[model samples]
Target chain A: MPIIQINLVEGRDDKVVSECVREVARTVSRTLDAPLASVRVMVNVIKPQFFAVGDVTKAESAAQKDKS
Target chain B: MPIIQINLVEGRDDKVVSECVREVARTVSRTLDAPLASVRVMVNVIKPQFFAVGDVTKAESAAQKDKS
Candidate 1:
């Protein structure tokens, strides 16, 4: 089974998530020449504070209002 | 950024998820030589019905109780 997991810190709306799954599924199906039934996708959303870069958390950057 | 996403049909408990995140973060850090703060891990839980194999959904297999 081919399973793809997408990580997102933002854009967690129902529309976006569903559309993403569809698009990713199509891409995986096409590239791997696999049936849609065989491809699996997972979208994992993390909180802002839990994800960081260079010791600066997303929450910190959001607090600065894109000042980075 | 190197992001790793893990898909799981089961094991969605709080303890399991948190431990998974920590373990994945550490692995990424060690293997890729990335800082712990820089590695991101997302755990996506998928429903049984939505996932399938060979036209047979996970729900179907689950219903069959490992009769595959």
Candidate 2:
């Protein structure tokens, strides 16, 4: 069984997050020739400060006014 | 830009991994009404030992003979 976890900045709607998980799991199952049931998808929405992009913490948005 | 990283057990076909990345990115962009260019997807494949599910390291597959 293959478990997939997606880590991204917080602020996503439930619908979008759920769909992304299902799609990723489906694609992997089909491409790897594994049973769909064998794949699992997990979503981890972290504070922007938890992630950094070129020395800038993406999680900063969680505490800032910017929503990007 | 939002970067999406998918961490999973290794041994998946290239086609599947690529598709999963694109699909997750697309879904998040559409559902969140964010620019497609702002969403980034990154995949980190561990050696199984880095991950544990119910006392079993999923990455153990990287060293074991059984492919789960």
Candidate 3:
């Protein structure tokens, strides 16, 4: 079984999320030649405060932007 | 930066989920000799209905169990 896990910053529309899950499973199955029914896709939508880049969290960066 | 993604079936306490994320980040940082500050951990808690095994969803299996 092939498991695909995706991490995304929260705030996407539900429709986009649904399409993403479906498309990713389809693409992975096709690429790996695995059965579509056996593919599992798990998505994690993280809050901005929980995601960071270069030691600055997305929430922090947003706040800094507001100050400038 | 090393990113670690974990997929877990839902129904865990919030405390446990927090601890899991923290411990996993620490372990990955230690094992990979990476800076803890530079490591990122993402946890995906999937709904039972969306997770499957052998083409049977967890929700479906549970329903079957209730029927028996």
Identify the candidate with maximal TM-score: 2
Residues A1-68, model 3: lDDT tens digits: 89997888888998999899999999999999999999999887886655554344556678899999
* DockQ in order: 0.15, 0.35, 0.13
The TM-score each candidate achieves on chain A is 0.85, 0.81, 0.86
Docking quality level of the chain pair in candidate 3: incorrect
Clashes of each: 0, 15, 0
Candidate 1 local lDDT, residue A55:
41
Number of the top candidate by lDDT?
Answer: 3
* Candidate 3 ranges beyond 4 A from true positions: B4-68
What's the CA RMSD of model 3 in angstroms?
7.8
Q: How well is candidate 3 docked (DockQ)?
A: 0.13
- The all-Cα superposition gives candidate 2 an RMSD in Å to the true structure of 5.3
The parts of candidate 2 lying over 4 Å away from their true place are: A59-68, B1-68
Ranking by DockQ: 2, 1, 3
DockQ of 1: 0.15
Give per-residue CA lDDT, model 3, range B1-68, as digits (tens).
89866677777775566566667777777888888889876666789899999999888998999999
